[model samples]
Target: MTVVVGTVCVAVSCLIQSDPVAGLFGASTFGLVSAYTALFHTPRLLALCWTAAAATLTVLTVRWAGHDLAFVVSSALLVALVVVFVTFAGRMTIWLLDADIFHPNLDALTGLLNHDGFHEKAATLLTSSSRTDDRFFVVAVVNLDSYSLLRSLAGTIGVDRARIEVARRLRDTARSNAVLAHPSDSEFVIADLFTEPDTSPLIERVQGTINAASARLTASIGVVCTPLAPVAKLPAPDVIDELMAVASNAMYNARRAGGNRVTYVNDPALTVLDAPPTDEWPDDDTR
Candidate 1:
């Protein structure tokens, strides 16, 4: 739309007015259009629009500046340069804005999304599934059991290594469409779609993966699988928060009962299904 409008304006100014100054002034509209494209559209579209603008400027300049090759070339080149400059400035502004918005939502150590990023992604996921009733939105919070003890025993470097390893294992276990976030130093969150209400298999898989990280390392995992049919009308952020809250509480319960286990909650009423105890944490002396 912008390209078409810009081209039409330039053509009308040059053909109807018959004044070289008016034609050049009207051609400047392309620069404005280019700026808009650079900010909101892709670089490919911007390039195509600028090419059309340059071609129009050249053709119109030749018709207006008759028999003067130097004047025509210089005028066309100047307008093209102005359009290019505007596009470059606009693109730089877009780059800076994107970096500012997304940098804070990334975990520097594990390269996963942070808390804010998780919320944004999960909200989008819920919004997309609002029209569907066959899917379940599963939110799980995984906490590294005895993490503080590991940190105290091995110091910062070992703790960082353990977190990275856990992140890797979770990434491998989660589905392709899952949204994973490292919300805290020892806790990771996962949100994904499931076809069934029973997520015990997934919960078991997560528990197994975390336990595989190290003999001494185990995780307390809490999960809540919500059917989209009931909460489709609710706000996505609210749903996400409720799910996370329930999942976090379940995780805390798991931790309180024992360090390494899986807890599941399927309803909003906070009913909990605790998994049987898994491999016990090795004695501190074993570390």
Candidate 2:
């Protein structure tokens, strides 16, 4: 659309101005405007192009329409300037939208995506993955061992500090292929997709990083690879829900095993599906 509009503008400019320099100015203005419209995804490059084009257009307007005070030409140029301003503003608005719509921070305690940003983006990623056959994904749920006890003993401020530390650790551990969401105070979800190989190793690396990041703190991780046993014919939403359920079950097992290990839904030991369990701190007793 931008290219076609630019071409038409150039043709019109040539018809209006028979001078070679005037036609060149018109063509260049059209090119710059079109480039700014299309290259908005690259902020630095778009900014350069926009600045140069605006300068060019200002010079051209001054050179051609000076001392004329012609209402028609002046009005057209004003309209064109407004359109260019709106175009720049549109690009900026999209950058803001990406931040607000796709990357929300979740409160570690409540288990909800703190803002709607993560929820919307996660849903979009799930939908896109479901449509592509070439993609396989896994969800890993992680929880800090006995994190609530710190909240109780140290007070709300202490708990908030711990949550921040945990979030920082998780963010550092996030891979390019992983989308991490906090679903609860103690729990985080890592959804990995678009990679050629399985994500088990990445999960392990993240688990190690988490353990290393917080001294005297450890995490119990539960993983659920999609296409689990008894595969489903249902839609992608159903499949994701099933994967989440499996991850929850694995989390339960991790807690049972003392909250310092990683467990997968397919782990043979999880077959029995024993009673509900509790998480306890190690005997370090450090506040």
Candidate topping lDDT? 1
- Which consecutive 10 residues in model 1 have the weakest lDDT in total? 270-279
In order, the Cα lDDT scores of the candidates are: 0.80, 0.60
Q: How do the residues 5-97 of candidate 1 rate in per-residue lDDT, one tens digit apiece?
A: 765665566556666656765677777887887787777877777776766676677676665778767777787788788878888887777
- The list of candidate 1 runs beyond 4 A from truth reads 1-102, 270-287
lDDT: worst 10-residue window of model 2: 269-278
- Total backbone collisions, model 1: 0
Error of 1 at 262 (Å): 1.2
Model 2 lDDT, residue 187, Cα: 74
Query: Which lDDT tens digits does candidate 2 get at residues 184-274?
Result: 6777787766344356677777778767754456888888765322222234454556567788788889999998888865423222123
Which whole-number lDDT from 0 to 100 does residue 216 have in model 2?
54
